[model samples]
Target: MAIEIKNTQENFWSSDFGKEYTDRNSRDTRDWDKFYLDTYGVTKTTINEKILGNLPKDAKILEVGCNTGMQLVGLQKMGFTNLYGVELQPYAVEQAKKYTQNINIIQGSGFELPFKDNYFDLVCTNGVLIHIAPENHHGFMSEIVRCSKKYITGFEYFIEGDVESVNYRGNEGFLWKADFCSIYKKTFPNLDVIQKDFYPYITDKNLIDCMFLLEKK
Candidate 1:
């Protein structure tokens, strides 16, 4: 499916896929948090040990689509301060606020974040963009980059090739194209991709996701 471009501010807030993915993701969190915890010991410990170990502590961090604030807890455990997050789902926002007393949790769209320009030392998005409409991906990335002062980190799931497809998570969003990373690099000329590696998530044996670290030049 070719991605349709949407420009309305309301669509940004109340996206169809966002609502669907939130519903599914929240259900997964409620049902699978314990199972995941039992299998992997400590909140995001496995992922953090693998992908997030190199990030700078004490930097202002903003996590987009921070469901249940698991990432916040992980960052705090790693000695990170000045943490903030934005979650579109009301339940997720409330759950995230309950998880972290110091972190700021805002309910808004990733494309239209409620913050001043260059507000964060790092902007991070984990498993969020796969649900966004493809045509709007560039605009959404622009918004994220605009908010970041020094760096941007992302955990993204993308498929290679011209055929468009939605991911296992139920959403009409963009799948990864092999050249999408090139597109991102071109969009942010000053943001140099420092590290990126493709990793297979054990949860789904067939899928491939990558963790990326980008620093401003």
Candidate 2:
């Protein structure tokens, strides 16, 4: 049997695989415009009307593990002025800055976000929580909530029950899927699920992407 290693955000995202992830969207303007929408159907309008319509346009927002900052770019185009992001990959950070302007896209880890408690109006993680190891999920989630003042949002893969590992490129225990909304309410009892939405990709039949908007009570 092979020894299963836990890949932290700090380590795996700094590796070449992470760089390869960003290289997919870099060096092309047209490719960057509708990247999130064309790929995941997650558009600036989807985020605005569905997830964050309640909040003001000037709300301070932070995206943890904002890969290439395309999502942040989408939010920016939606009239959101206060946008911020933390990316573990250096190449992703460089690419993000080059791709979008007037946004604070810093290089950092999701394990320990470098921000004061209750700093942002909404703290978000898009497709980020699914990658964290199950055991470390609590710490990561706690840090995310710690940095947010009002809301916490997650646009992630959804499964029915507990965290289940999935193989990524023949590597096991890297990607995961679970009921994140339930987990979030369980993890933080005071937080309530304000809204939730689900979307299945047109290209893939079985996979469902879920987004949950959670509010601290």
Candidate 3:
């Protein structure tokens, strides 16, 4: 018999088994925040500076999992206004709105974003791709392509497995199977993979694996 994953008020925006796993591990969100700030948070800001350098000023950017508007601060310094964020965490969405201006922080899922097609000049996220379920990876990636008018950047775990496990300090979960780069290439054939890397921006020195920067065709 197939094990069923039911949605609930706790994990309203998640897919099958997501609610149970996410709720079963409430500290995951807190640890997730810490991991980013520790690993690749500052590096990500520097990388985006180089990648987005000399791009059109006032480029509209959308962040798929903008937790509390941290990256928006970096983009603001980069002279890219017109920022938007979609987050599953209700608290994170609310806090994000408090810090940023002209930001559209929506409480929505990445798999089904509440935005029009091709609506942004750039779409980016840090440590977001691994959280989504394997079956839903295609849809989420397609949505990013559909909404992006210029570029897409993503940072995620690069482990190879039909189903892999990710451990954040004490929090752990099964990572839905999907290749980080393949999904982008397969979904948006026109887009070019501009940058890719794996490094230790974390305390453990091996927590984060994959990072990508793609330009729209």
Candidate 4:
């Protein structure tokens, strides 16, 4: 039997709302490329090349909350062979398997990742952290840190100040933005920053997205 999800955010993402999100975001590789280009002023390929190009092609990498596995597919295209993903919703998991080849995409929660500690060379989340409630942020970060053997990375909505909740699709209490990199560093003293950069939204320069890589020190 699967583990029970008790958290409100987890319950929210694992329900019909999550299925709708999957349906809305599911797109071809070309569309994804265009999306990154339009939103971040760069392609996913370019972002991957910048952040991950130096790592070995066979590095063990896992993506937390990898909806539909498009990020894994992009990594595969860049010649990375060992890739894995964990997603919450079964519907998203099904979509991921159909979209990816030779990649392991499992249905699991980020809060209780079903993996051995220090198993992955790099564990990452993209646009997943912002949805976590502030009260659960520490536990969530701890799990990601526990699974990462060498590096932890995040690409998320960023605010320079304290955590700020934002309404999503007109719903409150489901989304937030903060200085996520700083949070990780403060929460886990052993982590050291490798790379950190902010990309402004194309339409609104004041709105920012961030990507950072943290190494175990």
Reference-based lDDT, each prediction? 0.67, 0.81, 0.67, 0.92
TM-score of model 3 (CA atoms): 0.74
TM-score of each: 0.75, 0.90, 0.74, 0.98
Candidate 3 clashes: the total is 1
Q: For residues 1-217, could you state the per-residue lDDT of candidate 4 as single tens digits? A: 5757959999999889999999999888999999999888899788778788899999999999999999999899999999999999999999987799999999889999999999999999999999999999999999999999999989999998899999899889999999999999999999999998888999787689888999998
Candidate 4 ranges with C-alpha deviation above 4 Å: none
- RMSD of candidate 1 to the true fold? 5.3
TM-score of model 1 (CA atoms): 0.75
**Top model number, TM-score:** 4
Better of 3 and 4 by lDDT: 4
Predicted candidate 2 versus true structure: per-residue lDDT over 5-77, tens digit per residue: 2355446657887788678645444465466466567654665578887689999999998978877877877
Q: Give the TM-score ranking, best first.
A: 4, 2, 1, 3
Overall local distance difference test of candidate 2: 0.81
lDDT of 1 at 149: 90
Candidate 1: give the clashing pairs.
158-176, 159-176
Top-lDDT structure, candidate number: 4
Assess candidate 3 and give its lDDT.
0.67
